[model samples]
Target: MAIAASTSSPVRMKRRSSAHYRLRRRVRKGALGVLILLVLAYTLFPYYWAIVSSTKQGAELYTTAFLPALNFSYYRQLFDNPVFMGSLLNSVFVATGTTVVSLALGIVSAYALGRLDFPQKRVVLMAILMISIFPQVAVLSGMFELINALGLYNRPSALIVTYLLSTVPFTTWILTTFIREFPRELEEAALIDGCSHFRILTRILLPLMGPSLASTGILAFILAWNEFLFALTFMLTDENKTVPVAIGLIGGTTRYEYPFGQIMAASVTVTLPLIIVVLIFQRRIVAGLTAGAVKG
Candidate 1:
């Protein structure tokens, strides 16, 4: 029985290593290709539908058409509306403000934490990380009260300040890690050449840190741009809405269904800048992340 079992196992193993096994492998490859296509369809169908839908006018929308209409009426209406355009400008202002402020504060803080050794530095870093992970909802009331107290209620600046709660910590954390990987010897060499610490960071480090900075900045911009809760809560007036809040302001048909054509057109419009920005700076993002505070 033992001899028979040993011989049978070898036969099975040989079968697995044979042309039959190759056929199974091909079958799996074909199955995987089909599965990938299905997933691609599932993921992309919405965008495709949006494109198709955006081309139709409100009247033409009741009857579904798989083929896109060349009508630009929805787009014209969107651009012609002052409220929508104002909201778009407001989003640009808030998002830009947040990015600038966060990066300004983050680089200095990150440099100190990353390079300058101090007492309880690790503790401080851990605290920053912990704060970054905290639920935004937990501090919603507190932030709202503070904004009101600061007399910034219903202002674009209020959103700018509040967004820091989300953007700054993460920015600092990433920048710190990247900075820490810098060569200590370079700083030493700069110091010996009578360069100030600030000069070293500005002239030597900042240029080298471009890719990471661009990546971090883009991420910050996206966060601020897409932020809905704070935009909705703070921007009370019709004139003060951002893209996300502005989209909600436009009502749907039958009080339940959204104006799909307009909404999708706005979506398409809003997403183009992000896609362009990312495509332009994507290469730098990878380089910056990998250019850590380490040297060979």
Candidate 2:
């Protein structure tokens, strides 16, 4: 009876330990789920509120309400305004141009930086990093002078050139990371096949880099699309203005009055494209960002 009791005591302790671990795991999962929900709500609530606020009209806009009246008249008004429509086109053109030019240059720069050995390579990369770290306001005056000197002021081309300052560095940095992780064997194989450097980059490396390119391209587009300081400073004319500047120019009946409804409408209109782009490339973005995190 003494031996049986001692053996049973150990069995009971083992069962209790197993149960405790299971309970702890369940609690941890529950807490993690709650945290995720809170994070999602925090991140997405502002966008949801924007959508709700956009539907409110006139006096309704000032009223506190979670659900909007589902009105879309402001969107119609936005479409009717030629200046606003023109700004949309201008933003698209500038953003697209910036992305294309930045990526085109970034890929070559990244290839050189990541794959080749050269003198002062580290210094060059450090310079690019420092340039990216500089705030837009810090360089605004010099950029303005450069734009003016180049005859690009008041033109979409100005925004493209200035945007390359930010976009190219970012793309190059990200692509460099991806290129560094790429197997060197493939490049050597291509070289042995009598392929030129350009041919190898285009035919071999470029295709394998779709995820990184899409991620960086979309980010560059968004940055250029939403840029306000440069857009406001460089593009003075309404016809040349981007969406951000045009939205700020939305007016009311009186000089002191602000059109909240129309402002929200324009905000929603301009933001939808970015949201769609993000959704479309969500997978690629995740893959690009996580590519070099693990090794076989």
Candidate 3:
């Protein structure tokens, strides 16, 4: 009887210990979730404030606390502004052109680097990396001169070409990493089936790389859309200005007594497209980023 009691006592203690561990774990997990929520809120609060402020009227905007108050006048006024539409169109054109050009070149260069081995391959790649790492400010003077020589200053083409310099190298690096992960066996089998290199790449590899391409394209689009410096420098004319430059114009122009509402409205408008893009490509971006992190 004594032996049985001792054994049962140990079992009860073990059960209590397990319960305590589970409770602690649950508490820790709840705390972690709260921390994440706080971090997300902290990061997103500024954009949220912008959206709210944009919706308020000029009078209400200045008077109210940094919270949203629903008003339609601000939205209507923003559209009624002549330069708003033009700036939006310019942004669309530059972002689209930059994405298309960068993706086309990035895909070809990535494929070459991934599949073909040759002398000076490493050297060429190193050059690309070095150029990519160079600050945009460092090359601004040369780019400005080249744009002037080509008679593209203050033109959409100037912005397009300049944005390529920012997008291409990073796109190439990302796509090359993605391409290297493709199964060599598939390419070999395609060759065995008498498929040409172009056919294999176009028909087989490209389709498989859709996610990576989407992720890179989305990033390039965002960069081009949000770009301010080149747009400001090259597009001195209001007619050719992109959204960022347009926003700057609104902020600087003192024709209006108060411009905060208009500026905030423009900020909201410009940010909407980027938010939409992220929503569309969020999954692909996550997958592309995480694919190389873990070993199969």
Candidate 4:
């Protein structure tokens, strides 16, 4: 009887212990929820402020509350500015050119590194990775001289080529990692079907890597779009100035006289496209990151 009673006591104690553990887990979960909410609010506050300022007229912007006013005259005025349109177009051209060139080079280089066994492959990959870590300012003078030698200064091509220094290594590394994960049997089967290497890459591997490519391409585009130093140095004409340079030039009066409202409006406009891109490929970006981490 005592042995049976001791066994029942242990069972009862285990049940109570489990219930207490569940209660503690629920409390921790609730606390974690509150912490996440606070983090999200903190992260989003700057964007919220920018949106509020964009909706206000210039006069109301300085005088108004943190919340947005019902007026949107500043947004209208910002669009009316000629520089805005010109800068927007320049940004588009530069971003598109950079994306195309960077992706083309990255695809070729990544394929070579990931698939082909070569002497000094590790050395070449290490060199690319190290080059990517070098500061842009450190290479600016060399880039400028190179651009001048090629007579490409003040052209969109100059910006595109310069951006490759930043975009190419990361893109190649990411895509190569993704490419390596593809089953070797698939490529072998393609070869058995009399598909050439180029045909297999173009028709099979490239199609499968669309998501990884898009994620890297969009990232390159955004980097090129937001680039300021090279854009300022390479592009001299007002018409060639990308949005970052344009925005910088817009606010150089006295601090008191800065066009905060218009700046905010332009900020919102510039950020809108990036926000859309991120939203569109958010899943792909997540997948690409995961794949790179696992495969690389």
Candidate 5:
């Protein structure tokens, strides 16, 4: 009887230890879930408030309402304004042009840097990196002088040219990393099939580069779309203004009244397109960024 009691005592202790571990794990998981919820709420609350504020009318803007009024008169007014509509168009054109040009130049530059052996290759890459790290203000004066000298000031082309300075370097750096991770065997296989360098790049590599391109292109588009400093400086007229500049210039009914509603409405209008793009390309963006993380 004594031996049996001792054995049963050990079994009870083992059961208690197992239950304690499970309880601790459950508490830990619950805490982690709560932390994630708080983080998400903090990050998304501002955008939600903006969206809610945009729908409010007149004195309603001053309220602390959590839900939107669902009134869209502010949006209607914004769309009716020709200057605002034109700025939206201008932003689209400039952003799209910058994305295409940057990607084109970056892809070729990346291919050379990644796949080929050349003298001063590392030096060239370092220079590109340095250019990317330079702030817009640091280059503003020189860029303005170049634009004025080329008679491109106040032109859409000026913004595109200046934007390329920032976007191209980023695209080149990212694409170079991605291209380097590609198997050399693919290029060699194409070579044996009598494929020219250009052919190999266009046919063999480009299809595989879709994910990277989508990721980089969307980022470049966002940068150009939201750029205000260059746009404000270079685009002098209402006719050439981008969305950022246009939104800033939105006026109140009188000197005493601020157009908070209109401003919030414009903000929502401009932000939605970017959010949609991100959602659409989210998968590609994830795949591109995580391409070389795992070996197998």
Candidate 6:
């Protein structure tokens, strides 16, 4: 009886430990899931509220709720305004142009910086980082001067040019980090096979950098899309205004009237493209950011 009791005591201890470990794991997982739910709710709640508010009319705007009564009057007002439609178009054009130009310049700059050893490389990189941190307001006067000198005021080109200040630096930094981690042996092999630099860039490195490209491009697009200071400063005429400026302008003739309905409607409308882009390329963004961070 004593021998049997000793064996069972150890067995009971093992069972208790196993159950304790499983319980701890469940607690941890439950905590993590709850944390994720909270973060998601915080991030998405504003978008949800905007969508709900867009469905409300003048009277309904006063009634705050998660779900609102459906009405298209605000949308109708937004669509009926020629200025609003033109601003949307302008935003798209400027954002797309900025993405293309920045990405193109960024890839070339990144390749040069990442793959080459040159004098003043660190200085150049530090300069870019410095420029990025400079307050937009500080550079506003200089940029306006440059823009006017270049005959680009009130033009989409002005916004595109100003946007490079934001996009190019970001794209270049990310691409440089990512490109630095690519296998140099492959480039050497391509060179041994008589591949020119441009051909190697186009054929070899680019396809491999797809995820990084998507990540940087989408970020640049979002920045340019949502930028207000440069857009408002450069594009003065109502016809040339971008979505942010136009949304700010969506009010009644007098201070007494608050056009919350139309403002919500325009906000919802302006946010759709950004949401779609994020949803489509979220994996790419995560992969690129993680890979760059981990490998470097």
Q: Whose TM-score is greatest here?
A: 2
**Local accuracy of candidate 4 as per-residue lDDT tens digits, 156-205:** 78898899999999899898888888888988999999998888889999
> Per-residue alpha-carbon lDDT of model 5 for 1-296, expressed as tens digits?
99999999999999999999999999999999999999999998988998999999988999998999999999999999999999999999999999999999999999999999989999999999999999999999999999999999999989999999999999999899889899999999999999988898899888999899999999999999999999999998999999999999999979988898899999999999899989989999888777667776
Q: Judged by lDDT against the true structure, how good is candidate 5?
A: 0.94
What residue runs in model 6 are displaced by over 4 Å at the alpha carbon? none
CA RMSD (A), model 3 = 1.9
lDDT of 1 by residue, 8-41 (tens): 9989989878978899999999999999999999
Top of the candidates by lDDT:
5
For each candidate in the order shown, give its overall lDDT on alpha carbons: 0.89, 0.93, 0.88, 0.88, 0.94, 0.91
Model 5 residue pairs with clashes: none
How does model 3 fare in lDDT? Answer: 0.88
Give per-residue CA lDDT, model 6, range 1-296, as digits (tens): 99999999999999999999999999999999999999999999988888888898766777767786788788888898999999999999999999999999999999988988999899999998998999999999999999999999999989999989978989999999998898999899999999988888899999999899988999999999999999889988999999999999777868899887788899999998799989989999988766668753
lDDT of 2 by residue, 183-289 (tens): 99998998998998899889999999999999989898999998999999999889999999999888999998888888988998999878997998899998887
Candidate 3 per-residue C-alpha lDDT over 204-250 given as tens digits, one digit per residue, 9 for 90 to 100: 99988878988899999999999999999999788899999888877
Q: Candidate 2: give the clashing pairs.
A: none
Candidate 4 clashes between residue pairs 3 or more apart in a chain or in different chains: none
Pick out the ten consecutive residues of candidate 5 with the lowest summed lDDT: 287-296
The candidates, ranked best first by TM-score, are 2, 6, 5, 3, 4, 1
